[model samples]
Target: MGLLNRYAETLSELGSFVLPAPLKDMRVGLFNTTLANELALPEHLLQPQTMLDWLHSPVTPLTQQAFAQKYGGHQFGQWNPELGDGRGLLLAEVIDSNAQPHDLHLKGAGPTPYSRHADGRAVLRSTLREYIGAEALHYLGIPSSRSLCLFTSEDTVYRERPETGAMMIRTAPSHIRFGHFEYYFYASQKDKLQRLLDFTIEHHFAECKAATNPYAALLGAVVTRTARLVALWQTHGFVHGVMNTDNMSIHGITFDYGPFAFLDNYEPGAVFNHSDHQGRYAFNQQPGIALWNLNALAHAFSGHCSVDEIKAALSTFEPTFISQYQHLMLSRMGIETNEKEQSLAVMQSWLQILETNNLDYTYCFRQLALADINKAQCPFHDIFVSQENRFKQVTLVDQEKTDAWWESYRKLRLAREEETELLSLNPAVIPRTHLLQQAIELAEKGDFSLSESLLEATSTPYDARWDTHPFSKPPSSSTHTSLSCSS
Candidate 1:
């Protein structure tokens, strides 16, 4: 009972302690050996049989009491007070080799007090997606939660259809979310709210405590990190389908991967979550939605900071996001000029080219990075030749403008390590929706080989070896643009 179990012992008033409802015939489907070694997890916890027994057994010295966090959030722009960890539990906090603490959360563990009328179970299809999605984003250099292991069982769970029950152990700095503050704020629990703020700062943001106003400083830091995170997502064409306050982590990492997608054709208004009929969380709307979520969180700090101070903190969002996005977009194109306006013009023109040609987002960037400026006709040109033939959207005027943009780009100063920088900035492969569906289908048929291969491919997203791999290419024809939120 070291500091690993301190959260359960100290934060008892914030949540209710509960035991996990065991799954039948549970077995480890996938394990992150690298993450385990990085965290220096106990060797006994690495063994499947021992891990399963520990999960099912009564509380022990090592296995502390698990708890369901109580939180409230705004869903689809409507405030909902009755929301919490319906199907998840925070088993315990684990300290890494560097002494950094991370919450070991069990998603789909069992029903808790917040499981309002629904089964507290997760299916393999969704859990696998999350496991892959988290690793993919992490390798892509985005801040996100990471999966430790995936456990599947003979237990059946029903969603839109009968599916195999599964559980995934995801780790993050802390499980605290915007909703945690919101819940206490709205409930008028001032004492609990202050306790939470102090606890969070002490555990995660110790530097803030030295500031004149720690609460305001903490909010400002969160604003900057969230802005940067969303900028990275936009630059890489990733869309987090659900961005409710509860899903927004206070640590500013990507959380709750559900119905998320990467763009195939560069459409600004792409919305992949089937429930988003209004396109509220569409690709182009991500930045705006993020700011909206931040505003909701700001209300919780009203008692700690003045309205003007909170506004000042929130105001950093736009400039930070714009600067970060422009820098990333410029890097992705291999341009290193300090002239912000010109570089931004080039960035916009490049996006226009991709959008007009209806080209695959990842392919265009990878090909451009690999293109030779000395060659009159490089492989990058071939991508356009095929696209220009398929779509009549490219007029003579548009072609001229595109050619002019290319001429300017060719004349611009390149980065010191242009090709390497571009290659690293622009991933050769992403976890595309069609590819994920293929992996899921194979896994459902009792074959985890495809899933394992995908995890491996995604773990090294920038590897040149994947240049010609099937996973690098978007599906020839895709019917999975949008997905249900069942899982």
Candidate 2:
């Protein structure tokens, strides 16, 4: 037997209103049996037919309820009062082994109250991105929403072009976004806002409920989680592309993988989402943007908490993020964070080396993992031999700066270097956008094997065998592809 349905039982009490909507031609094209087993879905519900039916059936009997959640957000730093589930629906939540609720959300489930003058559908290109990207984050030991299964059909949607429809079952503890609280607060619905807050506290923030000031504790918990999450993203060179208040999860997971990218060449200012013209959500700006979003979320608590209380809670975000980021970066050099050698300055020097040389982020780190600790020379420079720098547009590297950083790293390594832990932290492979574009192109021409293969490869990304995989290599050209909102 798999998990039992409990979402419908507590759906109303949790403050999410149902907006029942039907989808067309929802046929299961691909099923992720691996994730199904991991999520521990009921044996009967694990089949593709059962998952397909439960997701699309209009008058559903087994765990069937279409709900479009309400949320308000600051899009590009402007208050967007009306933004909610447009192409997605929270179908149901299931009880796992420990009885924790995991939302069985259907992205690309079609139009609801939130679909404003647009077709509520997602294309296969983006579906595969989320499907593989979620699993990749998990393999990298980052906290994120998991993908259960993928479904595709003949349903067509208008994006940059006419595209085939696809949907993915995203698994998360709760689908309640930060914007959910903002939605009710902005609408002057104090009763609904309080109900939402109470429900959140009961289910997700139970620890906070026991605190002296439950509401303040809840905000503090979110701030800490978010800070750590962004720090992980920063060290891993992950650009989330979009950092809207609505896109930020209240539970602090790396959800909503749209136009996300890992570093191709070590450009701190790398912009992955083409739509983000201002570089507000660029690779380097993630830390600042996270704090900005947390500040925006703090405003929602104004009616419930005092100004002093809010300031105190929000104040911890920066130090927490910076400290965590330093520890992570220091660990990358095989230096134990608890030692005196673990300095943020050492990490910055390494970043400056990469920035000056314009090296491949993943490849350079991987080669450094194989470096001889006794050597003072730049060990990963060979990987960039005869290779052009994509960001700096040069074939020559700054040897002087690279040598200086190498000497510093060697000095730190002499004291306390744990190669095993460093290898564990830095991955040998990431779902490169160049390879992803190739896989998506192949899928467009009636071949899904590549996407399937990529998913499998990413599930164990640090495995040594992937070193020979074509995806392990960085792009050879400066013309790297950039994805947009549609992607």
Top of the candidates by lDDT: 1
> Each candidate's TM vs. the true structure?
0.95, 0.93
Candidate 1 per-residue C-alpha lDDT over 223-297 given as tens digits, one digit per residue, 9 for 90 to 100 = 999999999999999999988899999888999999999998788888999999899999999999999999999
In candidate 1 the C-alpha lDDT for residue 426 amounts to 79
Residue 391 in candidate 2 has what lDDT? 46
With a 3 Å backbone cut-off (N, CA, C), the pairs that clash in candidate 2 are 2-42
lDDT of 2: 0.77
Worst 10 residues of 1 by lDDT: 412-421
lDDT of 1 at 13: 89
Give the C-alpha lDDT of model 1: 0.85
Model 2: lowest-lDDT 10 consecutive positions: 13-22
lDDT of 2 by residue, 236-338 (tens): 9888899898888988899889999888778988897888889899888999999999998998899888999899999999999988887787777676445
